[model samples]
Target: MTTKKYSRLKNSFICFIATTLLILNGCKTNPPNAPDDTTDLGKVFISANVLGAVIWLNGNDTGKITPDTIEAKTGMHEISLTKDLYYKSTENVEIIKDTTIDLHVTMEEILDIGKVYVTSNISGATIFLDDEDTGKLTPDTIATNSGVHQIRLQRPFYQDLSKEVTIIRDSLITLNFDLVEESLQTTVLLEDFANVSCNPCVASNQIIESLTKYTYGPEKLVAIKYPTNFPSPNDPFYLANSEDCDARMLYYNISFAPTTIVDGILYPISTDSVSVKSAIDQRLQKNPQFRIHVSDNIIGSTYFTTVTIKVENGSGINFSDLVLHTVLTETDIEFATPPGSNGETKFFDVMRVMMPSNAGESLDGISQIEEEVFNRQTEISTSWVTNKLHTIAFIQNVVTSEIYQAGSTIE
Candidate 1:
C-alpha cells in the first residue's frame, strides 16, 4: 500500500510541474497579431558651419541649438538653421523609420551689419531708409547692412526731416530729428465785383490786372472776379453762376458794377489805380495769422481742389464764425463775340463756381498752432476752358467780413 501511495504522489508532482512550464512558455511568447512594443521613429543629427544656430523642424521651433540630435516621426520634413547676423540655411530631409540622418548646413554670415536707433521730436512719423519704406515708425531700432543710408521722416502739417547717416560695422548709432513746422506764406486777396456789360468795367479790369499781374504778381496777391447782374442781366459769367455772384455782391452791399473789394473791404465805383494799389499794399503789410495752401487737379471731367489751412498765430483773432472759401476761376476766358452789351470779349479771374456752396465752408475748433485740410471736387463744365482753371482759397471772418489770409495754385 505504501509503495502505491509514494508512486501516486510522484505522478501528482510531475503533472503540476508540466502545467507550470506551459503557463511560463505562454507568457514568454507573443501572439501572432499583436502590436509592436517600441515606437518607429527617426533621428536627425544636425550641425552648422557656425555653431549655436537655432533649429526648426517643419516651420516649428524645436527649442534645440546646433550640434544636437532631434527625434521625429518617420516622414518628410523641412529643416531650417538660423543664427544672428547670418543668412538662414534650409534643407529638406526624408526620415526613415529607426534611422538617423546627418545634416550639415553651410551658413553665410552677413558682413558689416550694424544697428540704428531712430527717434523724432514728434513720435509716430514714418521712417524711410535709403528712399525705401522700412515699414517702421519712429522711436524704434532697425538692423541693416553697414553703409551710407538716407533717412527721412514725414508727418502731417510738419516739414519733412531728412539726414544722411553713416553706419559702422558692429556699432550702434542713434539719430535724433528736430522737425520744423510748416508755416504759411503771406498773401493778399483781391475780390473784384464787376459786370461784362458795364462799360467802366473794362478800365477797372485793365487797371486791376496791371497791378496784380505785373506790379505784385501772384506771390503777394491773388485776384478773383465776380460777375454781377446789374448794368445787364445777360452777363454770361453772372448767368453761369448767379447764386454765388449775387451772394458775393449782396454780402458787401454792392449796388453798382466796377466795384472792387480788397481783403473784404468794399471800394464802391472806384477803379482808381493808386487807391487800389494802396489797399493791396496796406493789406500786404499785415502779418500772416494763418497759412493757406491750395492745390487743384483735374481728372476726366472732375475738378478737384485741396485747401490746407494752418493757424500760425491765433492771438487777437476771432476764431468764431471762421469761413474758408474756395473758388474755381477761369484765369483767362475769351469769347469770339461779346457775351454782354459792354462789347468786352476777354476776361481774367472770372468766377466759374464756388466749391461746396456760395455760403462757403464754416470751420470749427480752430485753435492756435493747428492745421485743417479741406478737399472739394466739382464736375468740370464743358463750356469752361480746362487749362485756364485756377483754384483760390481764403480764410475770412463771417461777422467782420475780414479776410485773414489767401492762397492759390497759380504757379
Candidate 2:
C-alpha cells in the first residue's frame, strides 16, 4: 500500500508541474501590457523643423519634437515621423541604455523651397530694395543685414511674389535671378506634357498624379500645367506656343513636361529624391552669394509691389530676351472640373495678366535696359481663402519660355 501510494503521488505532482510550466511559457509569449521595468529611460532627440512634426517611438507616439529634443527610452526603438509632403521615415534606432542620443536630421522636402528667385526669358526685371525703397539693380552691390529681409517685384497680370530672404553675418551670397511666366514647376505641367492625347501621354498623366502625390505629397508640392502646341486640344492650358516650349526644351534639353527645374536651378534626373538630392547637394555646397530684393505695399485695394532683380557684380551682361512678368496668385482653389478643361483641375498661379500677352508693352528696343513696371487690380474673387493671399512673380525667357528668376509675396 505504501509503494503504490507513493508512485501515484509522484505522477500527480509531475503533471501539476508540467501544467504550471505551460502557463508560465504562455505568459512570457504575451507579456503584460505595461512598460517593461527593465526598459531604458534615456534620451533620443528627433530631427524636425520648428514648424511641427509628429514623432513615434516603439510604435507608440512619444508626442511632438518641435525644433528640439524628444525624451525617449533607450536602445533600439522604432521611430517614425510624419508631416505634409515629406516621405514618412521609419527606423529602428539604437539608443544607448540610459544615455542621451542626438538624432539631428533634416526632414525630406516635399514642397519646393516656398521661396525662390526667378528671371524672365526676355524682359529685364526691376529690383526694388527696402533699404533703398527705389534703387538700381546693378550697383551689383545691395547691402543686406542679418536676419529677415523683404524683397518684391511687380508687373501687370502675372502673379507677383514678395518673399523674405534671410541673411547671415558675413555671408556673401549673390543670386542673379531670372523669372518664368506660366510656371513649369508643378506636377500638373508634367501631366499636361506627358498626358497629351497621344501615345504614352494619357497613361503618363495618371502615373504622374499617383507617383507625385506618393513622392511629394500635397500642399508642399505642385506641378505646373503647361499645355503646348502638340495638339492636345482637350487641355485648357494648351496653347500654340511651340516656339516657347521648343526653345526651353532646347536650353534645358528637356524631353517632356514631367520634367521641372527645382529651386529655379537644377532638374531632377528622374523625379526621385535620391536622384534629386545629388543635384541639390552639389548646389548647396556653395553658399548663397547674391541676394534678390522683393517687397510690396497696399494701394487703394490694388496692391502694388516692386521687384528688384539684382546681381552681385552684374555688369556688361547680354542674355537675349530676358522678360519679366509679375503674377499675383491665390492658391488652394479647389475645382471639380473646369469648363473646357481635362482631368481634375486644381489651379495655381492662374495667370491674371496685368501686362499685355507679349509679357511687356515695348516689343522693340528693350535690352540691357534695367527697370520695368506692370500693374493689376487685386480684389477678393473667390480665388483663395478670404484674406489668405499669395503673390508669385516669375521671370521666363519669352524666346525660350524657360523660367530662371522667381520670388513671391504672401499676406
TM-score of model number 1 = 0.58
Tens-place lDDT per residue, model 2, 276-325, is 44543443343322222335543222445565553333243234555555
Give the per-residue lDDT of model 1 (tens digit) for 1-411: 242244346556543553354334332232211222344678999998988998877654566899998876678888998676686689999988988889999999889899899999988777887764555899888777788988999765578889999888899999999888765556888888788788889889999888878999887999999977666655666666666776686576555567687888534334678878878888888888887777676643567888888787787866767899999988778778888877888999988778888789887676556567799988766466667889998988989888999989886
lDDT of 1: 0.77
Q: In model 1, which regions exceed 4 Å deviation?
A: 1-185, 266-269
Best by lDDT: 1
How does each model score on lDDT? Answer: 0.77, 0.42
Candidate 2 regions with alpha-carbon error over 4 angstroms: 1-232, 237-255, 263-265, 277-290, 295-305, 319-321, 337-389, 394-404
Any residue pairs clashing in model 1, and if so which? none
